[model samples]
Target: MTIQVDENEQEPWTVLRISGELDLVTSPLIRRRVHAAVAGGRHDVVLDLSAVRFCDSSGVGVLVAARRLMRSCGGRLRLILPARGAEDGAHVNRVLAALGVRRLFEVYEDVPAALDERTAPLSA
Candidate 1:
């Protein structure tokens, strides 16, 4: 299935809300969006993957690359992945956890939390 990525802003953070299957064909789209964000001098980014139904290795790779890119530019990258409820609340969350990379990111349960500078990330 095709993926949908919606870009928006939450103050200092650029929120990228992604939905649908994240596979080889669609992962590049996310990667490009991230690059654009970084190139535009917007360092802080929030990747909201709560709506993502499926996530593959390529998707994981893109997330990792995005994280790396933000770090290289002295920017911060945060993720939104609900830790409880059905299916771990997000497939991407489970995928990242299963892959042992979930702990590498600062993850929030929702957009508000992600955007809030005072809030701490959920435990991995």
Candidate 2:
């Protein structure tokens, strides 16, 4: 499946809402978006992965790379991943955990939660 990233802005945070499958063929597109966000002077961003139905290892790589890129730029990145639901709840979460790198990111159940500065990032 093809991956589509839609940019949704809410002041200090720029949300990249992702959908469809994120695999080898489509992961680069996301990598570019993350780069572009940093290039455009955005240091705070959210990756809304709640709508993504599938995520392969390549996708995981892109996420890890994004975290690195943002950190290199002194940026903050948040991810929206719904908790334990029958649909669209935990695919990315499981992948990140399985790879033993989930702790490197800040994950939230929704956009509002992720965007809240008062809320501490989830334990890695």
Candidate 3:
């Protein structure tokens, strides 16, 4: 399946809400979007992956790259990977955790929390 990335702004954050499968075929799209955001001088980014149904190694790579890019530019990157329901189980979250890179990012359960500067990230 394909991926969908919707861009929005919430004050200091540029939120990118992503949905659909995140695999080799679609990882580049995400990477481009993140790069575009940074190139536009919008450093603080929020990637809402709560709606992502499937993810593979390439997807994880994109996430890690995004984190690295944001850091290199002195920006912050946050993720929204809600614990959705029991069945869904936050697919991207599980993928990141399994890869041992989940803790490398500041993750939030929702967009509001991700956009809130005063809120803390969820424990990895």
Q: Where is model 1 poorest over a 10-residue stretch in terms of lDDT?
A: 82-91
Which candidate would rank higher by TM-score, 2 or 3?
A: 3
lDDT of each residue in 1-124, candidate 1, tens digit only: 4899899987788999998888999999999999999999899999999888888999999999999999999999999997746574377888898999999999998999988879999998
What overall lDDT goes with each candidate model? 0.90, 0.87, 0.90
Instruction: Put down candidate 3 lDDT per residue, 80-109, tens digits, no spaces.
Output: 997634355388888888789988999998
Compute the lDDT for candidate 1. Answer: 0.90
Model 2 collision count: 1
CA error at residue 80 for candidate 1, angstroms: 0.5
Off by over 4 Å in 2: none
Off by over 4 Å in 1: 87-89
lDDT score at residue 109, model 2, on the 0-100 scale? 79
CA lDDT of 17 in candidate 3? Answer: 92
